[model samples]
Target: MDLANLHFQNPEAFFLLLLGPLLILDWWWHAHKRKSTIKFPALAIAKKAAKGSKVRARYIVPALRMAALCCFVVALARPQNATEVEYTSTDGVDIMLALDVSGSMGTLDMLTRTDQAKLGVMNAEKVLKSGRFWDYSRLGYAKNVMAEFVQKRESDRIGLSVFAGNSYTLVPLTLDYGALLEILQAVDDSSASGNGTAIGDGLMNSLARLEKSDAKSKVVVLLTDGIDNASLVPPLHAAEVAKALGVKVYTIGVGKKSGTFLAFQQNPWTGEISWGEQPIPAENSLDEKTLSQIASSTGGRFYRAESKDDLEKIYSEIDGLEKTEIQTIAYARYQEKFYPWLLVGALLILLELVLANTRFVRIP
Candidate 1:
């Protein structure tokens, strides 16, 4: 709109505008040779456009096309208007999420409902007695909960590291949460199943992601349902590395001990519950002592996610970590202003096309 400040990125493209005059002259010469003269001040020509005869409309189409050509030439020139704007930025922490995918995580003991312990036990019973696999097992439940945790940290750079018998980085630290979530959703669909828990491998792999991160605060959230039975590096050794790197490690032990799956039922009509508890098997633990030490050594707390609610609560606590912030200075930037010209050119060409193909169709 401001002709005084109009800028064209590709000013050389305006040479295309020269074709408009030649096209109009060629059309006029043909019309004059046929003795079909048309006068114009285009405003007057448009006044009679709807009632114009087919012969008269012939001349109008070429002029409409020429006008469209001129508009397009302006668009090709890439006109823009530069304006100044201000912006502010914030510093967000770097995080790595390490999840366990060991065979023990396939146990149908985690809850997807409230009053987790009772519901968790009841749900496990239903899945077992009905002979149907609970697709949302310990790992499944963890993935679902962790997806929500990822969404809450929008400004931060987060990565994911998975471990079963071994550990590897699944996604590197970045701000692209959308792509991260899609990859996370596909973890169970793949055949990357593992048989043992390598907590140290997973933790160390996660720490490696933040090795070069320059953020003021770095953190790792490690969630697992099994003990570290297969790792070359001990979990404590990884914790020491994290402490030295000034990265906090929040360790979470999820699901209950193996062989402790509970059984309880309710009468349909009486609504009375009954317990058929078997003799509790010797506890198969997640080695909570080691997990706690790893967390404490890295200046972070250990959390026990005994049920679905507990798991969600643990993540909620980690989400409350101290956030770092720094002010950004305001600066000037340029914004393109050629969109209107391009849109106008496109609409004019479309109108000319519609008119020629329908109401102005030539018999020849």
Candidate 2:
């Protein structure tokens, strides 16, 4: 039991403290009334006798008695040291964050420091050649936003999975947000096998992790920036499986609607290299139709994030949508602190009695 957390079970008993001062005042009043004086004509014999007596030391006895009374009063108030403990039970949402780590995620189109700063992105690396700030890659922005999203969920059990040519669970469903954030921060384009995007494989992997979850609600937030190219199972079939299993899927397609990407070409005969910027048709690069179908099939919404700000809003909207239900029970355990006080009070009273009867004995 900690003395710092002391309390009183019977706090009303503290009213007894008023009696100590009253007793002292009554003793003083009686002592004043009993005061007597006798006139003496500057007698040297009387002065010598007064100087030899120890009358001032008698006050110590009353001071000791008053202290004992104060201690006794505090003990009667039932001093105790209390420690409170809380128990929480939750019917929380179980979520799986399905992320794409394909080679395309390394695109620098989304890496604008101005947009990243506007979106409140943290820990962005500057691309420096001539001493200038550089923007973050798609994977970098995703990681920062996802880390922020994970920190907002306090009661929900969250998991992470990444996919490219294949899919793997990075972290299982857990309440440990710190550990989850560490894994999310470590994720980059190279974290997974960089062959091709596997949307269906990623969704299936997320579902596999959530298959045994007994939570009230199960959800998967699948974010990708490219179309499905290497998935063995079709994306639609994966959505159908999720719908049958009562899982909701929210799909987010990231990147600009239309932009040009740098394409490189090699001349085999001349051993010459050439590169040029080519217009990347958004429709061909991103399979929005299939992503929308996957979302709607499982009673979820589809989002298109054109910029970092749009992505942040998308996550905030999802956070407001999925709410966890939690209940907390608290109890306190108390240790009685009155015994020591009572013993101290008794010892003080015994000491006062011994002193009053021996060294400070009074005669009437």
The lDDT for every candidate, in the order shown, is 0.77, 0.82
lDDT of 1: 0.77
> What are the clashing pairs of model 1?
none
lDDT for each residue of candidate 2 in 41-68, tens digit (9 for 90 to 100): 8778777775435688888889999999
TM-score of 1: 0.57
Error at 142, model 1, angstroms: 1.1
**Model 2 misplacement above 4 A:** 1-6, 12-66, 82-92, 102-140, 151-156, 175-197, 226-234, 244-246, 265-275, 281-283, 323-333, 362-364
Weakest 10 consecutive residues of candidate 2 by summed lDDT: 126-135
Native-structure RMSD, model 1? 14.0
lDDT of 1 by residue, 294-353 (tens): 999999999998778888888987897645475767754556766787788788788889
RMSD for each of the candidates: 14.0, 7.1
Candidate 2 lDDT for residue 328: 93
Best by lDDT: 2
